[model samples]
Target: MDRTELAQVLTRARTALTPQDVGLPAGSRRRVAGLRREEVAQLAGVSVDYVVRLEQGRGPHPSAQVLSALARALRMDDDARAELFHLAGSAPPMPGTVDEHVRPSVQRLLDRLDDLPTMVLSARGDILAWNSLASALLGDWSLIPRRERNIIWQRFLGTPDPRRSTVAMDDDERRATDAQAVATLRATTARYPRDPAVQELVSELRRRSERFDELWRAGGSSTSWPFDRKAIDHPSLGRITLDCDSLHVPSSDQTVIVYSAEPGTPDSDALALLRVLGTQSMTTAG
Candidate 1:
């Protein structure tokens, strides 16, 4: 991640919002597209030097309240707000988790979603278990080595085969995804702070990816409700953006992510093609 560029973007985003846009009066003789640093500082309840420090990427990390104020002052959306946290380098405080021994119940819920593209995920975005449809959608999940089963690991390490078309996610998308991965892991770390798997994953990511190292210090956090979308490519499906939903299984630390396409869209056709290929594979195996 380009810290300097990110800082500039924050400043630019703040400047892009009109005073009237943020419910401030538009005074005479303003010569910029958005709010001034002093205005943002006043609105966010921080000092001009702090805002300047933030824009220069040299400030103390802002508290959540200050961050929220800035986000509002800059008219940031949810995604933008999350990205700001990433830029400022502060993670959210952890929420409590249920005990770890409840995996069986979670697995049972996974079984119930047999036809959906669903899987049980650990706090680190690790694929603890998946339904048959998820395995099918992912195209040969078991073929993945254990160490690469985590979503973040897969994205960073999985190179597309020559015959497979590349799915290029911009740096922002990759960073956002990685931030979620880290925050998910952070939440898990809070509950099972001693798990060797979690420790190993964190250490490996930190050592390999400078971006991960930068975001790791920020303590980004997320929950398992609502959904996010990603345009994914499969050798057979070509390219499809799946609408993915994440939910927490009651009394467990695991999350379930299910993917689907909009009804009657071309993406839906791609999902059908995937199902056909999956059926053929099953028949051949049988």
Candidate 2:
């Protein structure tokens, strides 16, 4: 791709956007569909001439700060940001293509988090390792085939009925998570185009769920963020609202997700009951 040509097109696209598109009110329209070039430059904390130079590919290499400003100004998505990095011949600023497997120390941490529902997940949300609480809250996750252990795969295959009757779930919440999962996968594909597991999961989701297929094609994606106000119905727990926190372990592409409910609340009571049931289930299996 011609960097100069791409940069020009990108700048034009940014210019065509209205101030309202970037959450600014149309103060007084002059002659453009979007904000004036100078307005964008001002908003992005760059010189109007620099913006012009960038658009024309005559600018010097942009610093990360400037790139970030431009990304915001352009309202670029993950794909766009990746493209910007490629055009600039810079390594991705965020984690990418991690040789991400669960380390022994991380594994030990997972084991110790048994009292908490927790899992070690790859950047793409693969279930690399899970603690017993996670298994207890979900199912006999260990019994799941390794290939089927992924969150994306589980969403598609975990239920056969369109209504997901086997699991009590809020339809909207389930769909929201499903959309977020697809977006996460999309971002992963951009970063690790050759990962076989990601490819397989994408293929399976497309085949198994029409909604997932449509959402994936719609270009859904997200930055790593905390999951707030999540609910799940454990066969044993009945139902519980969980506060889920996802933490990025520095220097590794793995994330540790931990879920908990407030003490003395109904959800907490459900968690306790689920733990009892999990112990019983394990005993029976043993």
Candidate 3:
């Protein structure tokens, strides 16, 4: 690895981002111009010591997973992400792989949807980027481990955490959701047959989740749910139903999932309340 250059690049990238850019609170304590090392560690899901060592040009070469996390945390574009991999003596993700890097345009789109809960998901259902409201409406995805940040993984193998759970649904809705998730994953595996990450996810799900295995065995070609509405059982706000829409980013094979309620409705009011209460709760928790 080009330790010195990698260190320099990492430092530069870190300094270029503000806490707010990455859905972090900008506290009054002002010591650094950009995000602190701890903040980057939190965002990248790495240890603060690792971030420090890398910045000091003494850390071991980061694995592809670490590099990808750092790239996402740094909000690096495709070119910058490729450069990061090169500096680490690792090959940049190839074309056939599921794209995890969120394009700058997509990131901006997420940012602009300030009132709505929005997130970008890869073709394989990996949660790549999300807005603050998304965290509030769904769950704080950043707190989840990198490997478990996938929708399918959460649906099947993830431990039950009420705080992190998605919308509340009945058994019928749950089965439908599970089937859709499996079908979507099946379609993704077909599209990126050589992608190790996709293969690994499927293998683990089949091994661990009997329900997932059953659906996978009885495969279908459908990639979307027949229904788009969902009801979230918020701890504070009770049940709030919203229209969940998925917008496709065909260029990168990504989908931008957005949650919205009808304007001037109770659900809309509840969402607005979440914009304030949820952020404060997150900041306090952090």
lDDT of each: 0.63, 0.64, 0.86
- Per-model TM-score, in order, reads 0.55, 0.57, 0.94
Q: What's every prediction's RMSD, in angstroms?
A: 21.0, 20.1, 2.5
lDDT of 3 at 259: 91
Error of 3 at 78 (Å): 1.6
- Candidate 3: count of backbone clashes, pairs at least 3 residues apart or interchain: 0
Clashing pairs in 3: none
User: After best superposition, candidate 1 residue 218: deviation in angstroms?
Assistant: 4.0
lDDT of 3 by residue, 132-153 (tens): 8887777777788778888889
Give the CA lDDT, 0 to 100, for residue 203 in model 3: 96
Pull out the clashing pairs in model 1: 15-34, 90-218, 91-218, 91-219
Better of 1 and 3 by TM-score: 3
Q: Candidate 1 at 167: error in angstroms?
A: 5.9
